[model samples]
Target chain A: MAGKPGRKFQLNEKQLGYAMVAPALVLILLVVIWPIMLSGWNSLFDYRLNDPTKSERIMTESLNLEEYADNRYLVEQGVNELSEAYPEGEETFNETWTVVQNHHEELVAEDAMASSYQEVNSMLNDYEPITDDNLRIQSIDGSWGSDFEAAMDEQIEAVTAVQQQADGDTAVEIGYLAAQLENLQGSVLSSNFVGLQNYADYLLDGRTWTALTNTTFFTIVSVGAELIIGLGVALLINRTFKGRGIVRASVLVPWAIPTAVAAMMWSYLFDGQSGVVAHYMAAVGLISDPGALLTTASGSMFSIIFADVWKTTPYMALLLLAGLQTIPNTQYEAAEVDGAGRVQKFFFVTLPLLKSAILVALLFRTLDAFRVFDLIYVLTGGGPANATESISVFAYKALFEQQNFGAGSALSVIVFVCVAIISFIFVKLLGSDLFPERAKK
Target chain B: MLKNQAGIRFYIFLAIFVFLVMFPFIWIFLTSLKPQNELTSFAWFTSNATLESYASAITTRPLFRYMLNSFVVSGLTTVLSLLIASFTAYAVTRLPIRGKTLILGLVLASSMFPPIAILSPIFNFVTDTGLRNSYIGLVIPYITISLPLAIWILATFFQKIPWELEESAKLDGATPFQTYRQIILPLATPGIFTTAILVFVAAWNEYLFALAINTADAWRTIPVGISFYQSEYTVPWGDISAATVIVTIPIVILVLIFQRRIVSGLTSGSVKE
Candidate 1:
């Protein structure tokens, strides 16, 4: 159609069109691109929330190592001056800083140990061993400032237990070494360039790679299974029947509910202690333990895949239903006229006509599956030795729990790149003409 | 004739399909209606029924507050998106826009970047704007995700409607806005309704940003509120079932009343012949 407008009115079709889509365009820019540009800029700098100095410049809050060093030095100098005057308690007073650092390091290490992947790890990740006896974990919440003494008191109970286990001033050396090691650990961060280094770190880090593998496997298997099940259900639903609408609606109900609610519901359904599915599995000799589904890789994958498939199949079915409706009954009838059997007709006619719809549905679901996070996060917290940890979950931990946004962004960028490449490959491989009719009209 | 057998086979298969699809929902409701003891211990449909679980779930939080929050947010998002998406779709498809294909491609490619990748930036945006936990923060960023699909659908809808309608309106001395409001809009009603319902459902069920942004349980949606019931010590499966059952029923009813409408909405009126 030519853009020739038979318009005597003030504004023509083109002007009106521009005016119409303007609001949506403005929002798309204000929200999506604006934030992404800002995030990219922020990633270039060393952004730390606890750093008061660089916080003003970056417009995002972050802690400064220099500021922290300065503050620590002032406190140490004050203590030294007091020690030189008092002369009696210098040793004990000087041990306080090391003791506090020791406790924080121990706590962080213990958490890391608990979450680290057991199998499927490279030997490069193994580090110098630190004994549990000397190590002391502080259970204080995420803070490291004026409440340092309060935090020290929080870890005091653990320290008390340690004192009972160990004797004398030797505890001081143990604490000092722990603190020294923690400082050494912090120094490695000095090499951070705020670009692809962290991304490289993620690829190099054994934990991240393991999470990546786990995530890929989860995505492929879950999406694959959902498609088969969804297509089968869609084919069945495409026929006329009593209460057919109700059935279609119910299938969508799972998809309609929030993922959080669905995740928790499935988790309960798979709970070993009193879960219905777990009980059946155990009874059938499918599982040795009641909640073994949550405990192992294969089991957790199955539970999560089941939830994903159950929730998402309706979406696939809905699209496939759309595809099925587009297929002319005459195609099947024409095949039958040629003496094609029902099975042969279905394979030749239905499948070919449904190709575009199948591709579209698969593309949407596959992309969504790759980014699976909240479902797995809520169900198992990517746990039981990191068996269920997706890259998103790993990145979330790096950003939030570990307070390492550099590593987090790096992983996110990798995820973006990988998803983009995969999507491009899918679109190309699925036939450029897959949705030709839709694209044409 | 073979036609009769084919018809019978279709119905038979359809019945089996419906059973499988309906089973989980029936189980959820039946489980919700059952007492906590039976829900954990007994077979799904056979248990003696009770209304206490639903009552407990409702009573546990400011259920009214959650419903209100959901309504206000979803409602606002629906209205705003309809306005934006309809106009955008109209402009690109009906109006003359330069590089329309490029813009559509950009928006479509957005699905490639999962919300997780964009979250940090969006987080910064929300925080910088001081919109953290605000309804606008959640809704605005959400429009980014939902709008692309809505716009695509609406554009397709715009196309299906004959251009003569707009042209005729223009010949009557109607301004562009007048032409759209008086002529083309009424014809696009079904498409608009589809867009509204889809956006509402999406905003209603959104969890990540809703949870991440909003802290207070009183401000939370049904999904986030249900998650808090899970503690290290106790998980109330009964209440969770009850809550899900409550949230699902209204949408299900909407589906029943508007299944064709929904299907049309989904296909962007593609099946109309």
Candidate 2:
């Protein structure tokens, strides 16, 4: 109904540009930046999936009402039975029972905990499980929670002392009562926050150092080999040759294969009993036996480096080849006229001209190799005495396999820091190559 | 005579290099074709090559289902990322956007983020949202991971387009969106196609997130599915090799067909003019 169609709806160019970019910015912030911040926060806690007390990310002292109600019920019943059966210890039993009741009453009377307590108690009475975490756990006063825990501990000690002095059924009843008190004490879940303790502990840990060393070694050796071989191949392929397209396509095969599948393929090729590569290596005296490739520490390291070089050399070659093609033939002709030999042409012209390309390629491959996971993971699973464990694999095992989220998050943050440092160094070395237009300005 | 000899040497070296590069594929192919009994043999050839391994891999596991899941996830990621990246690329290249260089630099920097660094929070998020085993959960993260390169490549392509054409379009009373949709999108098709192939391949081959988020048998992708092929007692080498060959053949063909496009896309900004 507007006079001009779409005029009212059309945004100005600047606004349109920002509008267009908003979706991607929001998505990247949500999925990438936000998760990283969350991981950093998670690393501060002593979080673990297997440990009930430290399962959730808690900032305050809380109580597991489900656990509390169940244990409290049993402790009340046991205390009542103990006082009825043993008249001489009736006073001790009464005192402990009153202490437990008083602590329970005080916890239930708190405004923050009253609703959760009633809900959990009703759930228990109705023979229903307290499955919802928010309803089953409530944050309480920290000092009061700890005080109650200390009181329960005291009662447990007193009951154990009575058990030690008693005989027959009285001793068993007192011991059972003491265990119920211990259970009740455990229901008070304390904050799992440990600040930088995980990082501090990992700094002193040997496995962390080993993983770092292995990752660096792999990055250096594998990337070094790939650079040398990739440069040679790039020079060779950059020539005007017959069937160049076919050759180039074939060269990309290894690069195209998924790293995980390539790892599987190499695992088969390195199989001790049936592997062709292993058999040939042993026959040629490259190794003492075919079986050692995946089993021995040195051989496992060699195998990964070899596979990485094979897998990535094509990519390196392609990157360098792009750089190579950009160098006009006139430069080489001028060099030839100046009496520069083939070796001189390569050293003087090629390497210098290829500097940016090599740096870019190296930056990409180094960061990639440093974060190497699927290839090493599928090939060796960082096995043979953890000889081949990369930091990524270590973090993965800690996070997923062991479910030690706090330690795993710490490892993840460390990976992020190392990657950031590597990128910083490369960017510094790269100078203005990364932003040439801006550099000119 | 000397030149001829040098040419012969070069050809020989080329031959050897190509052979070395292709040897793994050849070896894996041969392994895939070998009968179950000859799988472990070190022989270069097997007289009894058969399709039994392929048959077994297909029948014993949901190989096609895994392929379908991978295709869906990769396809969705490619489309969504290409859409988002193109819009961002257009804005950065054409519009009077502030901090254009900084935005581009940030995009490049983000691509360097190690995937494992953010795996924990994303894993917890996916599990909490009940999206762990679904395609959308996997695609969301995949798009984020692929966006940096996609935007970079598209920006490069968009920058190469002449500014005169856009000015003319504006003079013709074409709105900015019309010029973008009608002129820019059409010209940038090849770049978009190149980015699609790269993004699709990346999502298809992603193992860690797929392994972690979609552990359910019904939702497993190709790489994760092949990883679970071993039955604790004996390694199913034949079946695995066959499945790998099956999965790899299409990707190989795709790379071969778009070899030039891929190379250009990969090295677009590496060597600045």
TM-score winner: 2
Model 2, span A321-398: residue lDDT tens: 899889887888888899998899999988898999999899999999999999999999998999999999999999
TM-score of chain B of each: 0.89, 0.95
Residues B1-273, candidate 2: write the lDDT tens digits: 012123877889988988988887888899889999898788879999899999999998999999999999999998999999999999988987687877777788778989998898998888878899999989977866789878887887787888999999888888788889999999889988988887888888899889889989989999888888876688888998899899999988898899988877878878765
Each model's lDDT: 0.67, 0.87
TM per candidate comes to 0.77, 0.90
Q: Which runs in model 1 stand beyond 4 Å of their true positions?
A: A1-9, A44-46, A50-193, A429-441, B1-16, B36-39, B45-49, B269-273
Worst 10 residues of 1 chain B by lDDT: B1-10
Q: Candidate 1 chain A: minimum summed lDDT over ten consecutive residues — where?
A: A130-139
Question: How do the residues A110-164 of candidate 1 rate in per-residue lDDT, one tens digit apiece?
Answer: 4543233121022112543322211211122344322443544543443333434
Clashes of each: 12, 0
